[model samples]
Target: MTNPLLYWLWLAERPGCSAKLAHRLLHAFGSPEAIWRADREQLAAADSLSRAKLDALADKDLTYARRIADDCARLHIDIVTADAEQYPRQLLDLSDAPLVLYVRGTLPDFEEQLTISVVGTRRATPYGLRAARYFAGNLAQRGCIIVSGMARGIDGEAHRAALEAGNVTVAVLGCGVDVCYPWQHEQLMQRIIRQGAVISEYPPGTEPAARHFPARNRIITGLSRGTLVVEAPKKSGAMISADLALEQGRDVFAVPGDINRPNSAGCNACIREGGAALVQTPGDILACYAHPRQPGAPRARKPDVRQEEQLHLDSPEVFAAAPRTMRTLEGGEPERTVWQAVHSGRHTVDEIVNETALPASDVLTALTILEVGGYVLRVGEGFCAADDVQLPQQTNEEPNLG
Candidate 1:
């Protein structure tokens, strides 16, 4: 019996075949297998296939595709075709969705869970990195699968935080799943594969190129319920992802940043132009998707100033009251140590880890808990104790640093 994936690989790897054209062909022929067996006249009958695409489809050379299948088997990569049950239904909504996806590790059930793409500049600032960590980590703890590119800076921080939160994260790579583009992220890539997945539309052994990323951004946003831009310049790839998310009819959320910063320009523009909703916290994003929309109803779009003001007015107590606080720090030793450090002015995670002499992972976990419980607030790149939250009395003796 012929490998069914061979037909998919052939359709995907055909020279000059764009996703739109492939989709058109799929619509005409119904399946890759049927398209592969179709004659020249049959292929010509398909709409929008130019002479070059038809000739490319006629070449019928499966040698390269066979080699890719071999490479996937040898490297333990899974090739998910568009028709596969495991293929994300979210991507199918796109008119130009990839015909195949190469995956390493388990692909989460994206249809059943909330998946948010966290994207931003590769050269991220301290504020961007911290915001990425805070939002991605907290969202992951809320059972949202974090999706990112696994690039340097913001993307890497998002993936790492999700992993640190002990939740799944999907990295949509421009390069092949078998190849790591930015050699620096080899360790991070490996961790994602072990814990979640690293996926690409490119077949195994395809190297990363500048042109691949714009297409890669579509997959990133397509696989998620929403996209969050932590920070971006006016013309960065993250902005492209946000635009693509909007085009895909997915919710676009951006963390508001300082107006003076160059890296923040895109996010500011997105919010100012009413292209994205301003996200102050993970809760803000969560609230938009809390209830399912009615069939054929519009997705979340540009926020209405009047409705926003009304919302704020309706919840005046939320802003009028003292800083929100939990009754007590109910967590055990790590939480207490981390909270004490933050309350005592150890603002950054590095400072808390150093001052408390706790492992970075423990410090981060504690910080997420404390932030969620309203004992600590994420202020800029660091943290601060929430006002009006009372702490247990301490003795003159130094607290245990263990």
Candidate 2:
């Protein structure tokens, strides 16, 4: 019961301590008391840890661990360990899942026949905003729990739409349940907690760091049945969720963007890669929900192990201090690559990642921005292409991501 406190304490005192290592120690030794009771030889011999790891958990760290456990008992924040039934089965597919989930609200129903993640850039344009609201409204009307980051632009629009539509929604957060990041979304997050829920694995009082977002995206997709991208740039975190969704055997959908606009690139490229489904309306997503979604389905045969282990910039410095770059500002990838090959032309997400070798999460965001900006467009399941020079539409409202 107090292991959460012990683990948090162990982590705070020992910087560079691995969540994976901490999780395993608690699992194997039964409790912090047992772990502290074990001699250096026993802790060092563990397959889960290196000698460096063993040394970091010195006697002083153990005392702090006990204190943390006591604090958890006092606060009553629910601690979900890996073995717990509430650990969220979807995250188990990840190569490195969070060891514990410090949850404040009720966990959404994974057994829901329809669970869809709607994600996009925080600085989305007008088109991105309309698309998010339209898609969220469409899906919510059909009884799907809308999942998203309570970010600005598309994510904010999605939550609002879900609330307006009078349906449940879930906001997967990058910080602790007690702390609200970005400040602007505080009101929306409170609303989300009242209806669907607000969830995070980060411990209480943990600051919302840049590195936490990409990792947060994993849990967003992991908790849902599928993910939909309304907008994103090449380097946006929204794409990270899409990539993870594809790997988890969850369907991915994207709203196309203008080729001239940068924000839609990550989403556009995802469609091109066959890693996601092309969606233009809520029906496109609703169609998948129409057929009974098989929750807890087994994964496909093993693909590239590294393919799934895509990098998400975990450095605190990256999140805390890195200035927004051109790629982040531009946001979209080219869409003409869909027919070229899985990794084919016009700066497709997979190809861009192959060429520039940027992380998948980074590349995916670019595609999203492109889609929302109308730079690229999704055609069908995880497929995207540049707008084939069609006559421009002057429509103000969104067409909906079906």
Candidate 3:
């Protein structure tokens, strides 16, 4: 008996066979097996199979497919065909969806879950990293599956955040699932495989290449209902993902960043050109979906409409004017003191620790909470209070630092 996957693997590995052409053939022939059985006359009847593609499809050599299947079996990897029951239904919506997916872990029911793709530059800033963690972690906590490329900087941070939140997160790779592209993320890849999935269209043993990434970006966005860009330069892969998300009819959300920063240029441009929604918090993303939550699941927080309207265009002055509220100010002891220190012009972490006389660890934790809550923004090596955040009156009683 012929293995059904052999046909898919053969079709997927065929030269000059673009995803569009493969999809067209699938539409015409119904299945990979049927397409395999198609004769020259039948292949000619298909819509857009060029002579070269037809010839490539006609070769039908199973050598590579058999080797890949053997490798996957040995490595415990699963080959998910486009027609498989576990294949992401979201990817099927794309005109150029992959015919075969190499999966290293379990796949979630994508149709029943809210999946968001978080993408940004590999050279991410402190602010961008914090924003990525804040949004990705919160979204995961709220039952949204986090998806990213698992590259360094923002992508790595996003994946880490989701994993730290103890939720499922998917990493779509440019290389094969068996091969970790950035050697640094080998550990992260393993963790994702244990908790979620690391998936790729390329067969096992395929090495990373420059050309594979842009094509990889499509799958990253294709698997999600929305894509969140934390920070990206004018011409970056994150920008490409944002554009692909729009083209795929998925919502694109961008975290607003300083207009002067080159890393922020793409996100700012997306908002300015009305290509993406300006995201201030995870709530802004959840608000867009507004789907019913699972029993006992956290309710999606609605975004502040007035504030969103003011900052819709992502104007620098508007952002500076509409400072985020220090919501956690009244919640804790050291946080209030840390906020007071930053508010009183104590910039760096050391300065805040010295001023508050709190342990560096405590001060750092408080500052992180403050920053992620939008009460403060990291500027260079130091931090500053958000502009226009009304400061509370000084209290005679000191915070309970003990």
Best of the candidates, TM-score:
1
Give the Cα error of residue 287 in candidate 3, in Å. Answer: 1.2
Q: Candidate 3's error at 203, in angstroms?
A: 0.4
| Tens-digit per-residue lDDT, 1-402, candidate 2 | 544456544554465566566657766887655665677778877645656766676554566555545555666667676667877777776656676677656666667447788999765654666678788876787688888888756788898989888999888888877777657567777788778677777766678888888888888888787788988887778888877887767777888777667887887887787666776666665555443535575432222324323422122231123333322113223322222222223233455567555677855665665567554554211323332323223478988999
* Each candidate: RMSD: 10.9, 15.0, 11.7
TM-score of 1: 0.76
Cα lDDT tens digits for candidate 3, 11-103: 898898889988888889899888889887789887656788788888877899999999999999999999889999989989999999999
Candidate 3 to truth, TM: 0.74
Task: Highest lDDT: give the candidate number.
Answer: 1
Alpha-carbon runs more than 4 Å astray in model 2: 1-15, 22-37, 58-76, 292-402
Output the better candidate (1/3) by TM-score.
1
Backbone clashes, each candidate: 0, 63, 0
Instruction: Please write out the lDDT profile of model 1 over residues 1-402, one tens digit for every residue.
Output: 888889999999998989988898888889988899998899987775778988998888889889989999999999999999999999999999999999999999997889999999876664677788888987888789999998876898899999999999999999998888677678889999999999999987789999999999999999998999999999999999999999999989998877877889999999999889887667677666667778788887544444444333222222234444546567888998888787665777788999999999999999999889877876435676764566666579987999
lDDT value, residue 238 of candidate 3: 99
